[model samples]
Target: MNKQNKHLPNFTQAISQLIALPSISSSQASWDQSNQAVINLLSAWFETLGFTITIQAVPGVKGKYNMLAKLGSGHGGLLLAGHSDTVPFDENRWLSDPLQINHKDDKLFGLGTCDMKGFFAFILQACQQLDIALLKKPLYVLATADEETTMAGARFFADSDMIKPDVAVIGEPTNLVPVIMHKGHMSHKISIKGQAGHSSKPANGINAIEIMHQVISELFKLREKLNLSYQNEAFDVQTPTMNLGAIHGGDNANRICGHCELDIDMRSLPGMKDQELVSWLSKALQPIAEKYPARLTITELDPSSPSFQQTPESELVLTAEKFSGHSCCAVNYATEAPFIQQLGCQTIVMGPGSIDQAHQPNEYLADSEIIKTEQLLAQLIQHYCF
Candidate 1:
């Protein structure tokens, strides 16, 4: 049961190489350069392994690439998907260099080591060990860009005619458990406009901030109502939840504010549609909009497709469970699973590392987890590809 010998050394090397590049999604300059570098390295590696590779670009971001590498051919194959972007990090906050993989006490400390790069490393290592001649069906590795910020890469891939398999595995950190279901997150900006006037004569002018408060109050009541109405046993929270993440208004204390804005974060269940929730909010805000000379606008930010729910009996779930030797469960976090699921393919979120380590300052993945992930991936290829 020596874990190091069970997984190939190339997986560790891949993790080290990936960690060397600071591909933080929010850092436009770093992301632009690092994304292409990572893709180029991966393309060369995959091509050497005798897999066909393709690189697709995001519309606005130059040098940001999405890579697809395919081995073997036919239906009912497995698609391994992962994002190449990491969240922004401050250099001063870390104990070690964030871009350099630091090994201590069987843990790998580095940015992007856990959030996603580890899974990509595992996939690369697994593919290198497989013989293309023995594969019965195609195996595709899809590495995407901007998953942390906008999910633009996943959205683009979902709409394309690229190699869609019968099943997909989203390599988000899941502690190696198969997440068959998860909630979808919807972010929106609510803006209200009204007439500005002197504070003494508040009645003479419409107070946008006051109107916004009223609307927000009504929205909170609606949120409570929805929370009470819908129920799902699979999810930890039985009902959808809404939070006003941020709010801004009033340029000066002396003058009545003419505009106000609030950012809303809504988590929708598997069965609930985002449009339904938007419609309900619109209806509730209508009265406030009519009472004052106010304008209400809702701008969606990173509107997710929906939450994915794979059947417990699905082959993909069964395969993942067998590989991990553990029972699967549902999670509340959103992922790229739903968009991949739209291709008539069952998708699951399964990978090493805990979700808690994803967006923190000193984000790192346990070296033992990486070793375990590498072995599990190798087993998957041996079982499904051979």
Candidate 2:
């Protein structure tokens, strides 16, 4: 197929345009911005390159889209996947416009420049050098939505009819290292309901605040059990962990505390399941609920992202480690790789720039890192497709 029938943005223009377009994906409604513009920009570029472009609308998320651009067709191929959206930025804290590409100290600073709309630009640049005719298997450029928030785009794509490649790479800033395993994220709110009464009449009503202490104690116990049961030395944090994020209860000191709510955050290891943990929690709190005649309920804040692990021996992981010259390791953060892995493709998270730059004020991808990424991706393409 003929490539670049029409003009396309060079690397600089591509990065600038992607950054200028606001595609902030946040759980807060006010901070959230549609990723449609980013997808459309990518779609047009892929179309110019003679790629078969298909924009899949994420089912319940209005104005959100997943762009899948195919360069060739076959049973197996290489997939360069990344999220189009970035985390909400603190504009006041930034030295320059967060939505504009600013260069300083040999770095390109902007939202999504590192964590990772810029990834697609490098991928596209690499593809420009690779002839489509030389590809025996498909080379797909995929951009998904809401990775900073819910990962809805990745979750939807996991079940979609898109081609399942034999190997996949998620461009989530890992400083050019190959990450084969990462922790999963899950959060919940536990609400305890009880009747209110005067402080003097302690027997008249159940004190939710008092009982919540017991609940918290039980949670601490559960956390210890979880920590002891699951441990992977590969991760910086060697065990599955839980945190008591927030809590709220009754009104004043004079009134007996009637209602209490606790929000929790749990990071699961590869072998652990959030559903099973929640079930255990309910069972553990059952006695307390019965003893105090308090109604205890547990509800999820958002869908859990299951932990992902690609064995070091897997071809994808080995190839990534070889190309990047970094040993396969684990990251502390969660990513879209787990969802992509569910499709049966051996996935590795390897991309340009350091993760410390992500979600921080004045985020950036260094010039050296960008060039290194382009060269590395070109080599990967040659090895996998040529």
In model 1, the worst 10-residue window by lDDT is: 1-10
- For 183-267, candidate 2 gives per-residue lDDT tens digits of 8998899998978999999999888888899999999898888888889999989998888999999999999889999999888
Candidate 2 is scored at a TM of 0.95
Q: Name the best candidate (by lDDT).
A: 2
Would you give me the overall lDDT of model 2? 0.88
Look at candidate 2 and give me any clashing residue pairs.
Answer: none
State how far residue 50 of model 1 sits from its true place (Å). 1.2
Q: List residue ranges in candidate 2 displaced over 4 A.
A: 1-6
lDDT, residue 288, model 1? 79
Show the lowest summed lDDT stretch of 10 residues, model 2: 1-10
Give the alpha carbon lDDT tens digit for every residue of 14-89 in model 1.
Answer: 8899888767687355544448887887787777777899899877666678999998988768888899888888
**Candidate 1: global Cα-lDDT?**
0.82
